[model samples]
Target: MASRKPQTPARKSWWRTGSAWKRIALWTLIAGVGVGLIAMVALLTAVYSTRSSLPSYDELKSSPNGQMVRVHAADSTVLVSLGPSYGEWIKYDQIPQVMKDAIIAVEDRRFESHWGVDPLGLARAVRTGIANRGTGRRLQGASTITQQVARTIFLSNKYDFGRKMREAVLALAMERKFSKDQILELYLNKVYFGGGAYGIDAASRKFFGHPASSLSLAEAAVIAGLVKAPSHYSPTADAEAAVSRASVVLGVMAETGKISQATAAATDPRTVKLAPEPRQNSVRYFTDWALPQLETLIDETEAPLEVWTTLDLGMQRAADEAIRKNAPGDAQGALVSLDRDGAVRAMVGGKDYVASIYNRATQAVRQPGSAFKLFVYLSALEAGHKVDDIVVDEPVTINGWSPRNNSGRNSGQITIRTAFTYSINTIAAKLGQEVGFGTVADMARRFGITTPINTQPAMVLGTSNVRLIDMTRAFASVGQKGVAVTPYGITRVTANGNVIYQHEVDTSHVLVAPYVAAQMTDLLQTAVATGTGRAAQIGRPVAGKTGTTSSNKDGWFIGFSSGLTTGVWMGRDDAKVVPGLQGGTAPARAFAAFMTKAVAKRPVEQFETQVTLPEWQLEPEDNAYYTAPDNGMFVDADGNPLSEERQPRSDDSEEGAQGDEQLDQDWIDRMTGNRPPAPQPDPGRAPPPRDAARQPPQDRAPPRENPEGF
Candidate 1:
């Protein structure tokens, strides 16, 4: 009882233990930890499930030979390959161990490793790279065999970390679905070696003139080295680099124990014994030009499809060779070949496709200069003017639009044939005026131009940009007796031996009557026989025109023979002047080179032969004026110069015209910063961007003169 009394008295003390508070905190912490554990478990479950459930390899269906492209000559030969298809796909067992080992050793050392990835190899590469730079700033790759295969099958060729993660997932999945041997074989077969070859077998034969089974160790190494950067390490682009890269591959293989050190060290990269003559085969320009025409035929997003085109590989090669032989150092060229039916037989966009992706034959819309005169003359023919009609090639102005002749001075009176043959701009402009700009644009559109065409008279003079394909097609219409056909690349496309798509000559509309086209043809014949396009002489008749745009931004030579139609273009990508050149210079020379070689083994033919000359000249007027904006002015603003009477003045007064345009001026002044300050072309000549149309004709400079001796 005394002890209980003492305990009660102790409770009355002010100092007290905080055990209850401590117990409460302990229970709360335990409950919070249990809830946190549950949340963590849920989050981790979601993460792992999502990660582990990534698309597996079993879901991926290998594209069954995505439409094989058999690039051919007029005759049959495997000129090139451009599809996931195959003529023959050999397994690793079929390949010589040397070649197989070289490829595996160079591409992926641990080919037989965990899943599809080579984690240890990757780690080693990253570690070594970091050690060298003492930082992770180096651009290095850590893709394993599976990753490489996955990327080729599922991704574009751009390097990034997202792509890396996707690659890992896909690689793991791929390993789960395909056997190691199958993955290795597919990867080897899918790799691209330059020269348009797509696999080891194709490359081996193309480069070494032998199969994969027969390649030597050095040759194998060379092919292996190309895996990293095919075009860059190509034997054609840089033989020394190819050899050097090969040495690196061989050394790597030895270091990784895939090949003996002695074998790698003794490998004679220099004595690799390449083919006697380097493979000069390339239809890059031609194929590039052809690719665009295919899009017009089908939906581009559909599975890769074969484009069985009419392109003759031989002609393509010859054209490339000619361009190389005759092209200027800074200049590039394009060539096109079509049949009478409008099937584009061969096309070359530029000398090298890998050097530039610009498809000069299709993507480049150049001013056809004199070549554009073809349409002008065609319009003249359609307007009931015969090839024998005569027109004056004299300097004249009409309706505020005046164009100069390419020859600098007019050649007095000339026959229509003579005017075209000589590329007399003044006469061509006269014909354009007669036909009307609307007529000319209509005619051009009918022939296949998908470009804006000004209704101004100058539109008749090739001011509208046109692609080489459309240009050639228009000229071919004349060759085809006026039927405008859509240019087609693929003649037949088959899948599983079943035709999926086929292209026949599709004549859109009658561009010009046969008689009119024929008449135009008769006139252009004179062009090849004597006009500015005479350089295309293939020891045969070729009727076409020479086009050189203002300031020499573009040069063109388009012509057609009885069997083939071809056009050539030369210019810079930005449409800037290439000083000291013309349509008949680089372009024509290349045309002649390609034509000479192309027609070498073919038969000779002419343009449905005919003779036409100026039968009679038109009568001269009191004040000879040209009409039509593109054709230069044929009459004054009142249309009276060539008519019965001329207007006296009121409306033509500058002040009256300015007053009438006062509203326009006000709006323009407001839209611009303020009121127009006394017009100035020089503020240091920064006279604000101008509306050339609003200015008086005299304010504009005369058209540029054609270069001498084109």
Candidate 2:
């Protein structure tokens, strides 16, 4: 053999006399050495590449953890977090052998020895895939716990080989970056274990209702099973699947020498019993209703911000419970509550948020029904009409318009207070006709009514639509002593622990006077104390109105206490009316539910609406005199009520103030919102109360026939 090889060294050139076999052997040896050197360089390069972004051992081992956003209750318990998970970080010496070994055995048996990738794993996966060609029983995962942990921390939700490759690459890098114990700690914190729980700490509390340090073997198996398919193998969702998975993990723990075979076989089937879940979805309904309004804060800001609000989560839950419990069997309801300062404390969009996201409190615009009468009556009280002022209720027509009471009967000669208490339509129409329509319209605006309303007399009947939030805000103004406050959800906005913006209270000054507001409050109190709102009465002197729209399409009950104001609206999601359902039935019931639950142990308070009442001035005469028309009072040349007679002797209207109070209580209650019809006098004369109207008798003709024409 030595004689054969030495000949090659003797002849250095290709053309020199050397055996062909010797030249071939020399070339093969050189090529093999070059390939080996190149492979070594490549392996070193790949290992270095992954380690570039990884932190050092000291950094991983010594640092304390922190999070991005954490929510705290007033008492300071962490309510929630959107941040890195924590709670379980044990040193290898302290970690349970079974848990640690199960993780390694079920995930990667060669974990203790491999730098990162295992050549045997790749070959086995390829073989398994080929064996299960079409039936789809392929067994493919060969990732070590390190690789899996790497993917969870840095990878996207997308599933593909590229991510897997990146996981393996990062794993190798991480091996160089951190020790084994550090890698395990990172893995524990990096993965998503489902149920909205992030770290082992949250998971412990979420699944076992305890801390991770105290988890039992049974509980440990449940957590171990979640590593493969969290949602599917959840003890809560599929106990059977979780049991099977846990069994497998247990077997691996024993086989891998992490635990004794006796220990593995000793696990009680009952050990993996799921923890009872509480109502995890808290205030979701209120937040859903508030989302659109919350978006407003975002629009007004420039940076990523966190919103802090005045929301009383307890009150929110109460409101939601009330609406849900009292909603009609087939109907849904919404409730909105606001503070006197216009801060929204709670808002329930519907009976259930998961069932539907149509936030009726903020989104649904429905007819306010008799609730609109609050504005109408408030206007009447402001225009110098007493709550006890007399108003007529008759079968008279104006411009062929006739209004009736809900009971479908004309109220005969009722006081303005009585008509309002009763919600009589005919009387309200007459009041609307007497007070100028514009007066009522202006009062409506002052009261914070934002919806577009018709100026016609029928508008007093609540023909326009209003949202529950607007109703809550408008009522909040009443509670705020006639100062309209816009209901705002977010009170303070912060970013990265720095307050970037804060909400300034907005007061829209309304009310003709403090006294004017007080008068309206008094009427509403009487409404709650004895009228349609009797159902809403609490131990306190709450004031509010009840509204049942035409055709019963919308039902509303809006009320307010000293510090809180609420509006309840009930109707079909569609505009179609639900028969037999009205404000008194559903909305009032909803309000009652909330009040009964909310007012417990709270002291009652009286309303401040007395300021609105004028000094108790009595009418001068019980039998006030009216001048005969055509006497220069409020008559035409023919001494007849001018309007109807002048319209080609039309039958399109009623002659004279045919309805009653000297006025119609219905009209005043309605506030037809006009300025008391300009205090018309008989066309030819004034009344006896004015000294025979200056003696311009019925026989006399006025200088100007229609000087104060409508």
Best by lDDT: 1
For candidate 1, write residues 1-710 as lDDT tens digits.
45553454445432246567777887899999999999778755544554476454334334442334655444555456665423257766887777777877877777886767677877987787777785546546577767877776676555677777677777766666578877877777766777567778878776677777778888989999998888788775678899999999899889878789999999977786655434333465555556555555554333545456677767767777776676566777777778778776777777666565456887787666566667677777877887756566567664666665432455554456655665555666677777786787887777777877666656555666688988888888788888775676667655445676776566667877888887887776655543455456666656777676554556787877755778888877766556545665567767777777666776655445443322111111200111101111113222222221321222221222222222222332332223343332332543354343322233322222232111
* Candidate 2: stretches off by over 4 Å: 1-282, 289-305, 609-710
> What is the lDDT, from 0 to 100, of the residue 632 in candidate 1?
15
TM-score for each prediction? 0.52, 0.49
lDDT, candidate 2, at 173: 84
Model 1 weakest 10-residue run by lDDT: 622-631
How well is each residue in 265-376 modelled by candidate 2, as lDDT tens digits?
9986456545676543435544444433534454332234455666766777789888888777677788888877877767788776545545788778876766777777
Q: How close is candidate 2 to the true structure, as a TM-score?
A: 0.49
